[model samples]
Target: MSKKLTIGLFGYGVVGTGLYDVLHKSKTVDATIKKIVVKNKDKKRNISPEHFHYDKNEILNDDEINVVVELIDDADAAYEIVTTALKKGKAVVSANKKLIAEHFEELYELQKKYNVPFLYEAAVCGSIPIIRNLEEYYNNDFLQSIQGIVNGSTNYILTKTFQDNLSFDEALKEAQEKGYAESNPILDTGGFDARSKLQILLAHSFGIKTVPEDVFNVGIQNLGDLEIKYAKEKNLQIKLLAYAQKRNEEEVAALVIPKFVKSTDTFSTVNDVFNGVKVQTAFADKQFFYGRGAGSLPTASAVLSDISALAYDYKYEYKKIENSENLKLTEDFNLKVLFRHPSKDADKFQPYFENIEEYYGNKEQGYFVGDISFKNLKEIFSQNSEEVSFVLIEVLH
Candidate 1:
């Protein structure tokens, strides 16, 4: 260990800057940033050679740099950068879930080929340390269950709905306005982010790789304020959950979707922009990791932890991707149930329909509250030829 460890960063966005600050200021004597690679930008402002660069080639080619840290979010570019760095026999660390989820096996082959580390600690759960937990402890035990409100955006939105009685649109607006969620939110609100984390954890805990699309995934788009109302009445909460379990030692349960949680549960208490993961295992019993799931500093803190550990002991850092088998996603993973039914204590809220004399009902007939099966609902609506024209679906308390 030296006073400083030379490193190269591919992105200068939020996580990149935070990584610079942490490594440069950490109390650790041996860990430090050597050079932060960047694309060509304004040169009028003063910048340190150790602070910036203009090309991916510059970072990849440098011999002084020992560790290649990638914060760039793109999956393809990250693949090229990481593979190239590993080919050159340099350590690589990244926070890209898409890349990790898509190319874990390929990346690890290169890692083991050169005996260099390929680390991705911040790829999941920000600073919660779930990946490491699964890799180290849970793997030893029989991890029967893994269920959590894994996405902060959806969790925050649901929390706001519970507290302020905000509509789906209203809560989503607040999330976007506060920068808690993306404008599209298809990824977070859709539960893809949690699925990525679940894939990585599943690989370690189960000794296999699972594709993003392979794991069962259902987003929060269909769920509305009515379910929130029902959850509240039953002393339950609405949350987007990323879950997996070993059903019979030979079977496994992994899916992402909205769930109604009982008030007595720890998950219901976890609210308002906070994230938590609950793991049920034989030895550890039940453990929960809760915090701000994402942000520059929180994610950076996880990255720095990886950097320090990789710097200290690169020997224990074997590539799991190479040894593990890919858990191919089934074409039809539709189990009868995605998760356990809502607790009996929780309100089973459904939308109600009332016929308000609509001038003989022409084209607008039924409201859609996501609870009903869309296939059946569509069939039912299609048969109404009597100028069907009135549909209204909302929370039926």
Candidate 2:
């Protein structure tokens, strides 16, 4: 029989409290929270104050606590807590995608060195369990591509904008008010959040390790009524999609960008705070995993699943990553795109595209449908022209 887990939980925010409630209510889970570390002292909490501590050593030095659950938002601080836990030979579970994506190589080495299980099912897609599925179920499958709506905050904002006729700003404000987005929502709106998750998935799906800066990602921050109206005219909905596809045997292409999904498509129907991941493999063909991508309870459920797995001595094998195949992540592919900008500045943007397939211009604004290399897309997108926007016409892998 597996040993009962004594958990030292860090961060008492949304998901933290949800985990506490769920762990207690779960009759099957053989884990108990021995200590919870939080920053604030006076903040009202759902649990008793006796269970909370302000110091990291309280949990890190506690030999009885064999599992460390890091749910903090600050990546730097999260790194410290996670590393300390691992060095102390404690199994670790975390939901911080940024920390995992940024220091994946180091964390992987740490787990191997300490010979401890480090599982993070919550970091990728709230309750979807994509990480575990990729690690175990899809270990032997020859994966062709992995793509979907990985971020829920932006999805919520986009859903409200198109479905409820709310403006982008209004929808974003509503998401923040409802706790779907953070107070400073740039991580979600700017596509950084999804990019982090994609980086983590690349290792599991294709055994490719890459940085967030190398991956070109443009989010819904520039989206407005113009794009929504354009989508409606074309019988489509705009979704922020993070995708990775095997271009050939040795090379794989990955990117996160806004795209037009046809009304008949699966992602078009995956609206609100829900996330859908479509994995294409040689054997299974295509399968879609859908669930709540963000929320206190939903995210906590994923975290709790990891805690349960730790009891049974389960950890990610990273089969694809450890395999002999030398897979490389590349951005050399060509993409069909729709670039919308002020008509007056149209000529300035003409040189960026390889060739314009179609063009429409008026006195106010215009759009260009053309093909552009992923490398050039990064160069132009860096200009950060507020008057301009870019969307994938279709994903060509």
Candidate 3:
């Protein structure tokens, strides 16, 4: 019989409760979920357990609990929970991507120092086990590229734009209604959510660290309807990709953007809110992992995997931290365009002028409307100019 590893669940939300239920449901339970800790000082819930505690201090002091399952996803609070757990020599399993991306290096170091495992299988592509696969098998393989529909919200939006002929706005609104997107959907659609996951992916795959801001990211916000329309005609699809690959020797890169994927590719066929991750490992060749990618139970399943692994490592006293840099492999570049918000707005615009002859008659770049609110002809404008592109307008006579 496996030693019963005790767990203290830190969130009573969907994933948290779902994990608790899953623990009970699995007959071959290797770990015992002994207690639950939540931050409802005055509120009541359907949660049972007279052992429940509202105070974090009280919760962390419990000696019986040797593992923590962190589903309370706020970055700041999660740092506290994880740190306290590590300090107490308790292992952790977290589904909070934001917290993990921000605190991974610190957490990894802490885990290494304390000789405890920090498992976060639920953070990126949920239940895929892609991270474990990459860390274990592909470390010695030369990786050419990583392309994926890592975010379900943008996938749903783009898929709608293709299949239902719905506008981006329309699709986004529908997604919002379906609970597929949050009220503040910027994180999902605007590429930050995927970028956060990209950091996690890159850290494990490349043994490198990146801040979310470091990823070369461009959201699907500015994609005009015409491009979406054109891509469909060409039998291609647009997927907001979370990419992390090697750019050069000793240099790694990451990107988050809407990219043109050919229709012939299986990734293009993967539509309507499903997520897929394509791997370009030398030995494995072209392999993909696809699924719901985001949800309560699906995410909980990955968390349970982490719980299982963390429990296994704790029970057997396994060497949980395995560094992958000792192997020989070439890192591939992640090609992409980047975006930066304006430092200065309406008062004084820094103009950016382009030599239109560069693009010539490239309709893919823009069109020659011959109307000049926006540049109809990209002439030899000064390279020092600020605003190169503007909205085209016409005057009524």
Candidate 4:
């Protein structure tokens, strides 16, 4: 018989409340919530006041609480809570991607020093279970690449633009209204959210230690209707893609950028608050995992999966971390780039490409296709930042 797992849950927000409800309903795991920690003690809540506590010690100091499930939004505070719990000899589970990715090495050390389990499955791809699959199923295989539309807010906005013909602002407003995006959705729209997820995946898949700042990421904020129309005319769809591929054993290429994917590709079909991650490997070839990338219940389900695993004394070995021998990351591969800008700046930007062709044009608005190295493309974009309005890299199958 399995032992009953006692939980001290932090942050009674969306995911936290959902986790509480799930634990109450689930019988498969013998777990009980001993206490819940929240910041706003005055916030109105339907749950009983007796179950809520504002102080960290209410959960961290409780000897009966064997597990700490953190569902907070502040990465720095979450890091403090997680490390404190780990030092106190409690198994930890979190859904904070930013915290995990930024402090991975420190957290790993704390887990080892304290001899406790720290699992974070909900941090990436929501309920897709990609972390467990990478940790167990694909651990032995030679993973070639990981490509996906990992952000649902961006996906939903893009879907509205493509299907409803809404402007980017209109689509983003709709996403915010529907609770798909935050009021300050810069992280989602700017590709930082997806970049954080990619960093976590890189550590799990390739044993590389890196941060979002080091990645070559471009968001969909600058995409225009003209670029979308151009892609559709060419039987392609534009998607904000998070991609990581092994260029060689010593180096990996990773980036988050807008790509002109073929209409028939699985990525093009993953639309509207949904996410799909395609894992390419030596043995499995290409395997796709699809599910709701966000929301209270979906994310809660992933957190519970970690809790259930911890109930059985499961912890990530992170074997890839030890096996990797100083593998470097780069974004210098070749790419076919599509650029849209004002005709006045054409002379300045067009010369950077190796081979160039005009796709569509007018006296005011014009677009061109060109072949260039990804490094040079980024440099050109930085140099001519204001002139270029849209850029999309051609997806290589």
lDDT of 3 by residue, 1-397 (tens): 3557888888887788778778878776588877777877566666655757777766578899888888885879988998889878988888788987877768777876888878887888776777777676676777756767888888888889888988988999999999888888888877888888887777767776656655655567555555665567767777888765555545554666566677677888778778888888667688888887877788888888777776457321112224434322222321221112122332222222211111112333342222121221122113312433322111100
Q: Note the Cα lDDT for every prediction shown.
A: 0.67, 0.89, 0.67, 0.88
- What is candidate 2's TM-score against the reference? 0.97
**Residues 189-292 of candidate 4: C-alpha lDDT, one tens digit per residue:** 98899998988888888888786677778899887878887876887877889889998878888988888888779998899989999999988799999999
Off by over 4 Å in 2: 383-387
Model 3, backbone clash pairs (residues 3+ apart or across chains), number: 10
Q: Which model scores highest in TM-score? A: 2
Candidate RMSDs in Å, in order, are 7.7, 1.4, 7.8, 1.6
Task: Write the residue-wise lDDT of candidate 2 on 306-397 in tens digits.
Answer: 99998899988877878836899777799888888888988888898998988988788788888988877777767755656655556563
Q: After superposition, which runs of candidate 4 have C-alpha atoms over 4 Å from their true positions?
A: none
Instruction: Choose 1 or 3, whichever is better by TM-score.
Output: 3
Highest lDDT against the true fold, candidate: 2
Clashing pairs in 2: none
Question: What's the distance in Å from true for residue 334, model 4?
Answer: 1.0
Enumerate clash totals for all models, in the order shown. Answer: 13, 0, 10, 0
User: What's model 3's lDDT at 102?
Assistant: 79
